[model samples]
Target chain A: MIEVLNPTAGPATGKIMMAERTGTLDGLRLGVIWNGRPYGDRVINSVIDLLRQKYSFESVTFRKKPFIGNVAPASIRDEIVESCDAVITGIGD
Target chain B: MVDRLTADRISVENLDAAMELYFERGWTDGLPVVPPTEMKVMEFLDYAGLEPGRPLGDVPERDRVITAEHLAINAVMAGCKKEYMPVLVASVEAICHPDFRFNHMATLGSAWPMLIVNGPMGRDLGFNSGMYLLSSAGNRPSSTVARAISLLFWNCTESRPDGIQRGQFGNPGRGHYCIAENEETSWDPLHVMLGFDREQSTVTAVSTYPGPYQVYCQRTANPELMLDSMADAISTYDFYRGTYILLVPPHFAELFIQRGWSKHDVRRYLMDNCKRSVADLKRRGLWGLHSSEYDGFAGVAQAVQPGDEDRYAYVFKPHEYDRIMFDDTTLLRRSDIYVVVGGGNAGPRLCFLAPYGVSTDPMTVAVHPV
Candidate 1:
């Protein structure tokens, strides 16, 4: 018989569970965090504008990460968390 | 002693079955890996004088805490010898550094780590710093050492294609990123230049694009003309431009040395001379919809040279592009470019590893041999 160990760091620990779904978008504050890629702002803002035609939002906040190659800074995160109720962030090209 | 291994061990009927199991589990890098058996993992830890559970560091962005046990298992699977444990451990620490930006590996840019090994340890381990150092010529120490790190990228950091590693077009550097700075040079070795003792071995991990684009400049001995050729290749319009690494061959180094040009002199020349004009700089290569307006040239990823009215290229200075009426855009500073002398004395060509645009500088860490 032969034995070998698992290669990965195994499952990640201290995983933050997915936040509860807001159930609905109407009357909720909308936050959009776009990676600073070209036209990303346009792609996101256009969608928010479309959504606004269907449902009323208390307010909408737009934030751009400092750079495309970094995580959002704490100040930006605080602004989003404090001013907005839900966020929409995009990934990959 | 370190924390006992907590990883579950699976019993298989034969080696082939174990390999099959590894493949099914998505543990291998599409190649045969030595089964990381219990004894081998413990031996690797002992060679590095590390406990199994000792946390090397955390790749916080990936939400992974790399431990000595994880390093050992991956190292053994990559077919590395026990003696290579220290180098692998050191490389992990360097890559985990915030400045190194371990989190940004998975992107359309497809940036991977290039390890520049220095000190006597490179020689002791028979790392090929000569011809084909970057090729798959089976230089055991360098290949296995780099492979071990790649395994870490796969297993611990989730660099698999199906996983978080989203490279638009990946290259072979993903498998093994050529390392081992040719210590046999007229100038101080890379480690010494990076402020380390001549005796202490170290590894510097830089987030680099995969291709080591070769710059052929053997016709003239003049340093200025050589920079004209090399600097043209270095100055590019790729995703963007930041720091660059130039592998200067011995013959190429001779041309500069004969002209009384030190490494710093070569860097300063590239910085001051290579600049692009303000008109050329107006085209937003990747920033806007004007990528097509790049001087009627298609895929001219190399940064646009100085346009008419201005006479400069790329060498990046922190000046406002619109305000500079007479100056061309600069790409990087003297300190941003790292020139290392390596490769066999025979080759007339040099290699350049370009950066992935705006990124934190590559970080170097000392290899603490046990």
Candidate 2:
């Protein structure tokens, strides 16, 4: 049998494993963060529209990242957290 | 001690049965394996002078600690002889090198590790260095050793064939991509120039994407002109945007030797002279600025401003062209330029510039005598 270790440890482990729960989509403000790839924005926009039609969600906020293959800056992540109940991020070419 | 079933010596037939069992269990890479019998495994452990449970290294991404016994088991499955353990150990060390960045590399959508063996071990293991050396010529220990190591990666790591190790277009090298330096044919041995003594056996593993693009310049006799051609070849759209190069075979070294040029001299020239202008890159449809979040022609903005000459100058500074073409020259320092003498003595020097996003350090395993 193979013994597996925790991939991240110490401070990194705590941050990585912390999960936020999401409730129903109805009337919830949704945010989409796009990583400048064309398909990413399109995918996020499609999801938003579909969610809106299905759940009659209140509103949507959109943020576009400047670079591909990189994570959004902490400020942007904070902005996303403050502005929307739930956020979806995407990356691609 | 008359014949109990357990007392029987595990013969070749029993080994074959075990191989079949491994296949039935789906533990192999769809290839037949030489069953690693307990005796064979023990032999390998003893040959490597390793304790059964000695830790090879921790595979971080998998979070699994690999012991010497684990590797020995896989080596047996890969049909590796007891003597090949040294090479396997070295390869493991190279992969686990902090600079090698194993976690990111394995998960990338690239092919399996491209094993490039260097030093005296190449010759000792009967690695082909002349005439279609990289291609399969059969029964070469170097080829099998590389194949075995790759197979070990698949079996041991979380990166399996269908799961995390997702390679879209895998090359044949994935099976066994290894060769040695034709040091006897070249002016200076590859490892010696790279700070290792000529007597020291070393292996340099370069993570590469696919087979190299050939840059042949048979007609040019002048070394300067030939080098310019080589620089131009390396400056192609794909290469210019990428990082790392693997200098292969006859042509490159032969030209230098014929003209009394050193590896350092050639490197300096390539760094100084090889470049593509921003205008050229733009003209070739290589450079473009697009919305990072969007795709297609609509998202693509002109990479360079039409009238911004200063920005253009900024992008194409001296020595910067080579950097742009292949990341930074810091990457192209003496350490990164892995030279191996191979292929026929004649023809253009075959240089393979590695594609972008591939790791530059190769995984090297030493070959021990069986």
Candidate 3:
């Protein structure tokens, strides 16, 4: 009999934990973080601008990462979580 | 005699059917596998002295725990001899290292792992360190071991081409890339340069942009003149500014070796010469309003406030200020420059250029013999 080992990661058992939903976005502060990729900040800023047009935001703050091709540092994450109601981070280029 | 594997068994009428079954299951790199039978994988595990479920390393980014059995299966499938298991195991450990940044293996760029074997064991395993070092003709063991890693990345971490490994311009090196440092040619073996003992055998892994930019230096043997040519290639506008591996063939490296120059000297020279002008970067559209402080223009962006037509006009101290140096990425500090010797005596031709980035540096792990 021939047997082959299973190389795939075992079944993906971790559940996706979603954040609590807030019904309204009115007057909530939003944080924007860009990972230093080209044009990521512009895209995020445009997104926050669009959000401002629809709902009134108490404040909007932005943070730029020091490097690219890396995960955000814990210190940055802490700052964003402490100051903003919702944070948006992404890659544009 | 080898015992049959205890993992789940699939009864196939013949080897051909087994190959087809594996292909259909997407358990391959779109290449013909060796139809890893029970005996082949068992022998590989035994050669490495590893238990079937021993955890080799984990790619937490992909939620994958690479185990001994998983590697053995892929090694057997990639046509690796049982004796090559220890090197294969060490290679798996190197790539899974957090410093290697296992997550970047899935990036939508031409980044892929380049494996370099160093020390005595490299020759014992028949790894090619001469002409066509990265090619199949130099060494089957090197190529097969590299191919096995590629297979593991695809099967274990789910980095298939059209899947997570989104290489915009896919390369042939993505399939297999491994080389043995030409230990005899260099002042020091790569492992020793990386802090391992002279006798120790190790594998160095780097997630790099695919394919090497070959540099040809025919009759000119002057160290400075040849290095000037290499520095120009290193500063090629298309080359990313980061850790670059220069595979200097024996004859080419001999130019400096004859002059009694050390590897450190080569690195310092390259660091001094491999730089781009700030104005060149701006002209290439790389200086778009980013917040990061560039080499010459520190805080110049904040100084040049918004809504100013001549924003950069005052930024230059003089017209010569535009000629100041800069790097594309800050991760590769001046000290991060690395060099190694390899390639056959096939002329004075070799290659060098930038790999992925500095976020993921070259990782080295010793290979322990069973």
Candidate 4:
């Protein structure tokens, strides 16, 4: 019998814990972060508009990442964290 | 060896059966891999003087910390020799360099890591810097080192097509794409030009696009004429403004080097000439301001009509794939061209390619072998 080692990085740690959902958007502020993907802003703006019609939003803030393919800067992320109840970012090619 | 190893080991019937097990586990680059037996991995780690838990680097966004154990295991599976370990390790670490912005590997599925090895190590180890440079051509170091990095991309970095890797067409370059620089041209080697000692071996890993498309200039002995051909190819339409890399074969290198044209001259000349007329771009349907970056044409929107060739092309939107800059578009920024010499000894052919989805640009990491 031949013995072999598992070649993968093993189970990923990213999805190990799920974030707590606010559960309702009736009075939540929406945070939109666009990573410079094509048409992502339009899609997110449409979603925000739909949410506005379906439920009351305290406010909506939009932020563009400094560059695509890199992490959002702390300043942008901090503002979103402090000013919004929830945040959404997207990836597009 | 088994007791010392921390990775989980699976028992299989034989080498053939081990291949099947790995295939079933989704751990290969769609090719048969050598069974990463405990002894094999142990030897690789030992030769590299690495402890199993040593952290090579990590993809912070993915929360994946690539360690020595994983690299050693993957290297063995890719059929790499112990001597190739240091180059391979340095390559993974280079891409994992936080600025490497590896996520593009997923989003731009058409991309793969292309390793450009520099210095004496590659030459001493027999990595091909000559004919059929990117092909295996019976060159073990060239083929296996490239494959090892590719497997790491697939197995460790999660560059699998089924997951996040989104390249519409599976790029064959992803299979194995690597080449050593032919420093014999007597011009400064790429490493020295990038500020490394001639003695220091280094590896630069680039997130490559679809091709190392051949650029031919066989007709002329005039360096300017040859460069004009290369510049034309570089100006061809593409989705993003990518940094360009040229692989100059020996015959092509002799044309300029013999005439005392330094690498700087090549870079400046290409920067000045690697442009296409707006008329040509429009005829090809590659000209437009579809990006938000061009929302107002930076106040010169009037200068751009159907085919003006007015302003030098620049600025692009993130989402728009085809629509590009206006005016006579200069494809390469002054510092955007990276020229490295190495290819077959006789071809008038050269390779013109570029990196895609870049942030901080490609990193050249020094290799430290044990």
Candidate 1, superposed: residue stretches over 4 Å from native? B1-3, B236-239, B277-315, B322-335
- The TM-score values for the models, in the order shown, are 0.88, 0.70, 0.85, 0.91
Question: What Cα-based lDDT does every candidate model obtain?
Answer: 0.74, 0.58, 0.71, 0.75
- Tens-digit lDDT track of model 1 for B1-370: 3437878889999889888888889888888889888888999988888988899978876778999999999888888999988788889899887767676677676888888888877778777787776766778778888888888878887887889888878857765674677766577777888899999999888778768888887767788887877776665534234577888987778778878888888878777655665445445332212221123323334454444336443444443431222111112212367888878788667778876644456888999889
lDDT of 3 by residue, A1-93 (tens): 454555455444254245786678898888888876655566777888898889998888788765566667788889888998987776546
lDDT of 2 by residue, B1-370 (tens): 2221121133334545656665665557788877665566677888888876686766654555566776777777676777778877777777666555465433344644555566667777777677766666674566667767766666666456564565666655665666677776556666666666666676666666666656775567776777676667766624333234545466657667788777667666666555555665555554432213212333234455565333331111234333333222123322334445666666665666454342233444443433
* CAPRI tier of model 1: medium
Interface RMSD of each: 4.5, 11.5, 3.7, 4.1
lDDT digits (tens) for residues B69-113 of candidate 3? 888888888888999888889898998887776667656666887
Error of 2 at B80 (Å): 2.0
Question: Which tens-of-lDDT digit does each residue in B157-238 have in candidate 4?
Answer: 6778776687888666765677889988878888899899999999987777777789887778888998888777777746
Worst 10 residues of 1 chain B by lDDT: B325-334
Which scores greater on lDDT, model 1 or model 4?
A: 4
Worst 10 residues of 4 chain A by lDDT: A10-19
Candidate 4 lDDT score at position B103: 61
Reference-based lDDT, residue B258, model 4: 89
Best by DockQ: 4
